[model samples]
Target: MEHITSVHNPRIKAWKKLQRKRERDRSGLFLAEGRHLVEEALKSEVQVKVIIIEESVELPPEWQVSDVEVIEVPEKVLRELAETETPQGMTAVCERPDRHNLLLESGRFLLLDRIQDPGNLGSILRTAEAAGMTGVIFGEGCADPYNGKVVRATQGALFSMHVQQMDLEEAVDLCRENGVPIFGTSLSGSTFTAIAPQDSFALLLGNEGEGVDEALLEKADQNLYIPIYGRSDSLNVGVAAGILIYHLRGD
Candidate 1:
């Protein structure tokens, strides 16, 4: 039954600081707002230090209640802590969940190369998780997975899936080491029907505007392209990724 009402409260200031990345890294914590994400964080093995729930709210049965300090905050303060337009009236400060590096273990993977748009990355991530890809590697220049938009777009898959950050070259090397062949989607590459590999594989997806790096593209063991019969020459990376992931997953 503790309370944190004032915006100037020291703890409040610290919580707000998490809006920036530096503070998040320095503190080893990030903010999770809304009933769903916070609830998911609690269910996850991730460490949750404190939960700031709105005053007078009856929480879901699964919300973490005993292990951590629960504080009651004013609605205004809840709005300040949340990133969405409609504040969920709940937020928690929790440790960054550990992402599994399945590329080092599994033979199936998805490598995203510098795909910088948050929404596309998020959508692809959601699709990847649903498709049961063993893991997802974020190439060096990809958008931040922890970005609020991406995190929200994934719809809580971040809490469950294996997500990693590494350079595209190193990722390809990891796949090779683990006995997985890398596949890249590009125009003029052989049609997916022509060079399809078996179920065990890795997909290298590129940014929307620029596509894959030639260096990595050259390294791909399989070059698969989705044909476009219409005027558009290329599909949105997210859409292409979804199509490729579904096919590779044996949809």
Candidate 2:
């Protein structure tokens, strides 16, 4: 495989376009850079259409990206398509995650209500995957889960879980129709332990400042809060979300 010498190459142009969220959205595609993320995508069954690696970078045999075009690029050219400050010298164009069409068929779900920070959303996604969450739902007012920071935060769990966006009420309604309960964190409700673990439930998290929406709280099946002893007014959204996810996982 010849290494690309020209950053002006058409393939390079198309990938650079991915730096803009609109282009990624318009094409329903996103670029995951680095050896590990691409490898994880492959392991998680994501379709990799193009992989660009630096000169002489050896690949493990099981990478198994048979139909995908594997090409080498000059380190500078690879940097041109990269979003990171520290370029990893590898990148892969992947199909956008297709978890939207899925119903919350799994009894366990995480609902992020108007959770606006990309990093928080990303960390929550990673935690959800680690805590064995069945799926995640991002409702209105939440940041785009596919945003670059969020994508990176999930590590490769973005490929490992079912994630979808929806209206808050409709998402809660979907869970309700299937007989699953929804839990939201607040300053009051039952201590996490008091609520016995059910086989299925949705853990709802709200905006960092506003807490869960009043309408959503009205709709939720259980309003629960973490018992905080610290002087701080509330926990970070990511920390709060992690606590709830673990509790539901039966901590």
Candidate 3:
């Protein structure tokens, strides 16, 4: 195993840039911090390029994979690459999966439109994976799923599901081709309970503040919404997503 002692090491500098969206896009890889995320990535088919661990942290015997390089770094170097207050002492660089495959999968999907908050996007993804949804589609204006905050919030779900980004209109057209009914969430739409759960469908969720786009809403086969009986005018996008996703999954 190689050891890095300086925070200014060339590799450490490059890993720090992974914190930015453009860097991740350009490099076609993202940093997975902590033992849990790294372990999950290793278990998946996603190619693990390099694993970095703080020198003081012990390496699990299971992490002794033959093909990948393992580097032990000092606390300062680990801290520079960490996004959390308390570093987990381990991180890995993993190749981003090909998202074009997301369009070919046949199952229920959660299509997010302009979800700006990383926390909300992450939580919704976690819920979608837990609910056995096939994948997630991110439309224009949505936060990047690979962002550190979003990945951390996903709690490893990032590696478990198929996630892709594209325009809402094109996504709608794809769903039409697949014979999948597109359901949009709207305040004035039908009550969610009114729509029966199905084997395959696409649920469209909109921005936190604006709800679904008017053009997309108009194209939806059906628009459904949860009844807000209490004083609160609306639900947090994540909370609303949980309610709708599980109910629609119906299993």
| Best candidate according to lDDT | 3
Tens digits of lDDT, candidate 1, 19-125:
88788768778877778777877887777788899996767776557888889988988888888899887887888866644545455688888899999998998
Tens-digit lDDT track for model 2 on 1-251?
55677899987898789877788879878888788888888888678888888875777787786788888877888888888888776888988866668676556798888889888988999999998888888888888766777878889888888888788788888888888888877786677777886778888899988989888888888898877798978789899888777777674
C-alpha lDDT of residue 24 in model 1: 78
**Candidate 2 TM-score, C-alpha based:** 0.92
Worst 10 residues of 2 by lDDT: 97-106
User: In every candidate, how many clashes are there?
Assistant: 0, 0, 0
lDDT of 1: 0.81
Off by over 4 Å in 2: none
TM-score of each: 0.92, 0.92, 0.96
Q: What is the C-alpha lDDT of each candidate?
A: 0.81, 0.82, 0.89
Ranking by TM-score: 3, 2, 1
Candidate 1's C-alpha runs over 4 A off are 62-64, 100-105, 195-197
Model 1 RMSD in angstroms? 1.9
TM-score of candidate 3 on Cα atoms, chains taken together: 0.96
